[model samples]
Target: MGCGACMTTPRKKGGERREEFIYHRMDPTDVHAVARKHARGHYCLCPIHGPDDDADLIRDTYKDLGYRLNHTEFFMIRSLSRIPRVVSPVTLKRVTTIKMAERLAKTAARRQILPEHVDAEDPPMRVYVALVKDDIVGWVNSVVADKATYCGGMYVQPECRRQGIARALLAKMLRDDRKGGARQASLLASHAGAKLYPVVGYSEVGTMMVLTPKKK
Candidate 1:
């Protein structure tokens, strides 16, 4: 099934048309509403809980649920605030750098395989980066389908994890993506992301594994 309303065609079997919803840029006023939804577990976004009321149990809570922290994959907003002042910027930079490198590697890998499909000059993709106190803290990549968007790489630096920075960034993107006339957004999640994605309103489609050829 294709996303008749957006840019790309859907690749799923069921032909079920998942329409994207309204998108708008979230402002400060929206935070309260977002927090409320999170508190109720109805938000379906990550960090899967209300504002950090009990930091001590946060790790235990997820652990009890058998959720393992893909330390690198967890784009936690709460952790953003919890990070010590001295280390936040350094960590954010490391994350941004790794993310950029990964993107480049992925692009290089794709280039080698010319996929009988994509053009040599694939269009430039845009990813959003968010900062706390002017320090890079969170990031997410987005793609278009018809008018809708499929969110790609979403991550927050390890030192900045769990501090609501990611949530804030995501809320902003969802609003912006929708306002751009996108009806829906989707993304594949990592292990730690498994717990977070559902909290922010993403449902699992299935799983995938990537195997790359080793260097000769």
Candidate 2:
């Protein structure tokens, strides 16, 4: 498991150029060596609720990399019942169509989902697509273990952002989970997804920090 630690920012508030750090999770065993070859642009940091108070591991890991934890984010949990149904042109589809798979392949590089795995007759994971007037607009995937629904592969098209598609998909997700007899649902929310989850019944349950290379 990785942890967070931060360095001291310069006290000068005026005209001081602020440095930004992006977090990445990898084989933490050799971070200083591998990170240089495999870095990507940034995205939102997911919030965790209450984090472990022990800073020893986080402190020690970054100390070796010459970086420090800047801030800790809270991740959340919520009851499915807390999500209210939303009405929109977006209708949730249970299967991933050919276009859906291709669209995901082109834009979902960060998602790390295998193309073959997306359309198994009885996939080990459950997948759902969102449609806007017959065009695939978004999609999500989840797996149920220990009576909890762990979500992933949540994505919406760029052209369709801020139009309530993600929330509508989430609403369908929770609704279907309840019908499937699940008691609760959980997901690792990105900074972008955090805005939608809290509105449902999820609350901060833990914390995680991102690590990126320091500027040269």
Candidate 3:
């Protein structure tokens, strides 16, 4: 398969900047060249997705280039109609302003929010924040394409997790998407999310490895 990549420069927790090359369904033979080309003069992260059998080879190739495995995410999907509806105990509101998006990003430890995320006339993404009184406790977003919705950035505060905030957020998002005519929903889930998503009708369809350049 041909390689496809999207580049992003996101700041780490301590204000460190890193460039990421997120590759989707890349061919094994192209891994080394693509990574080396983009890794020059900056800290680089390569999250690669490919055939399951090539996973080990891809990891070894990256290791030789001073990249280490940071994490693995499961690619999951489910029919929107199958997602169970859940009621959030807290309030859920659409994020329609830069201020609201910024707060959600900071609270969720996510990347910076941009205008496209909260555009009034034509927003590319739909974000929902969970509110317990006035405090934003959790958030999720969805991007719809070709009758399918890609759900992501789901997060809840550490103290608020076990109270079903995630499930409620997911259900609300998927329910809205289904009503909007999206038949399928998909997301890349972390280990913790992998366990939770199944409860809302998601099934793992594939896996991807996230790698970062080894620090000196």
Candidate 4:
């Protein structure tokens, strides 16, 4: 409602113009509203041809939803391993205070990421973050469901990537998953993120296909 705007724009393939709409970012309520419009309940996407490992499909998904692509993500799961590499130089902690959430919100805003209310009173979700002198440089989190533990919300400061911060964050996620009696951990990884998950013992189970809504 208060987060989007619309205007006319030329089509990508032809001379005809069309209305372009975008939701710069969505809160939890906004996410649910889209799902409700789609069907009776939450829905998922199915690839038309197959996984392309490109951003085009994801882009279309945003256009159809009247939202632009903020991140191109892939799907993965943690594989069974005798040992998971423990990366260092970063301390991990679960987000539990408003101060932490405020800091994370600022970081996500700078990155143009979709914001989630990660720090709330008795929050239902858990977010683990990597701290560098009380500043969040990287983090990961998961939501446990009846079927599996879906891990996401992974981010590392631009200057912090490739420094083992992501690896350390994921390792902590897996540890938390096991601690909570979860047997499987899954995540939708961004294109750049695909590289980081594998090092933490996750494998590509399948490629994710993002589809846009059709015109009426």
Candidate 5:
């Protein structure tokens, strides 16, 4: 039996506040009951990841309940033993303060910085920022668990890309993870990221599908 998980976020739609339920790795048998219980008067999204046949069955089940494909991503992973030692032209700094996280959130247009961004708890999380002349231009973060690091929230300003900032940030994060005892890194790569991560040593392991209710 696959274990199901959900995350809820509040959003504003047409001047009205609503919630969105995002389900991850949910069991197929539990989908309808859970969706009915939590998705009333709200948006719901299910991101399925696994073997093709299993994912297809879950997708078909959602389709029968009026859901449609929202997007797809590649599930990529790489061993951390051989991260390239790319030198960043821009300065890189580890974010360890709420003040710094707030600045990153503002520059990245993120909703807000949470306590966990700087919390020193187990399953360690780390955020790194790229700076040019004291201004943040790119950032990336990772969370380590069970000897693997999951990387996400990677972004580089439009004007600052193609100059190796993204590569630098990734290299720095992966190297740090390796030093910290993580043996591998994983991420769900968007279309654009699918192109970039391969250059950094990640290999596609599977496809992930994001499904949402069809507009009526």
Candidate 6:
């Protein structure tokens, strides 16, 4: 917290005033503490109390967390994304209509969606799809929370398997989410997703499981 007193202020909907002091570019060299707070944790908007994308700030944040920023200004351990070739042109589209969800739901009801756990919905969720020549090749569902983004479902059509469509959809989804404002993205990687996340710049920081009771 050294450099100086920095505050983040965001205009309220009613044009009111609000302020917060989280972290700042000049905050001190012991950034590890700041990084620790953000380690496997929700990212706070820049601490300088303003809107800015500073490479120096990103570098310092990682440095504070004991993560080295390489010559390219990305985490030393992770590779900056290399845009993968699509192999074939597949249209990626956001499922703006509820119809798509309904479509997925119907497919789920028939157990066509790899995992049967995808059918239930509380308030329903947004869906994204990758289509080829009008055929549904892949789909993903996500819900956002204060701390993280939760991916509920990701399934590639059986016939489209092994064509790299799933990976393309995943990469597109993660990039879209990050662009939309996510400090970090996470998902309950299925058996297949566990293998894919790392390829797209996501590292395994934890594990997840489902608990259920058995009926005697």
Which candidate number maximizes TM-score?
A: 5
Identify the runs in model 6 with alpha carbons over 4 angstroms from their true place: 1-88, 110-125
lDDT of 1 at 107: 37
**What residue pairs are clashing in model 3?**
none
RMSD of each: 16.7, 9.5, 3.0, 10.7, 3.2, 15.0
Each model's lDDT: 0.43, 0.59, 0.76, 0.60, 0.77, 0.49
Of 1 and 3, the candidate ranking higher by TM-score = 3
Question: In model 4, which runs have C-alpha deviations exceeding 4 angstroms?
Answer: 1-73, 80-85, 110-124, 214-216
> Model 3: which ten-residue window has the lowest total lDDT?
43-52
lDDT of 4 by residue, 1-216 (tens): 235433343233434544333333334345435545544322333332224444474455546555433333566877434338686777888776666766776766532112354545433457888999888788676777643687747778899777888777777777767766667888777787787778777787655444334435
What does the lDDT read for residue 82 in candidate 1? Answer: 18
User: Rank by lDDT, descending?
Assistant: 5, 3, 4, 2, 6, 1
What local lDDT score does residue 138 receive in model 3, on the 0 to 100 scale?
A: 86
Ten contiguous residues with the weakest lDDT in model 5: 10-19
Runs of candidate 1 with Cα error greater than 4 angstroms are 1-125, 213-216
Clashes of each: 35, 18, 0, 1, 0, 6
Show pairs that collide, candidate 4.
74-189
Model 3 global lDDT (CA atoms, 0 to 1): 0.76
- Candidate 4 C-alpha error for residue 10, in Å: 27
Worst 10 residues of 2 by lDDT: 40-49
The residue-by-residue lDDT of candidate 5 on 26-82, one tens digit each, is 554477666767764655655646554577676788798788878888888999878
Question: Which regions in candidate 2 have their CA more than 4 angstroms from the true location?
Answer: 1-57, 60-73, 96-103, 106-123, 211-216
Q: Could you give me the TM-score of model 3 versus the true structure? A: 0.81
Candidate 1 per-residue lDDT, tens place, 40-99, comes to 221211232223334336445444443333332222221111112122222232112444
lDDT (Cα, 0-100) at 68 in candidate 2: 49
lDDT of 4: 0.60
Compute each candidate's TM-score over C-alphas: 0.42, 0.60, 0.81, 0.60, 0.82, 0.49
> Between the candidate structures 3 and 4, which one is better when assessed by lDDT?
3
Model 2 clash tally? 18
Query: How does candidate 5 fare on TM-score?
Result: 0.82
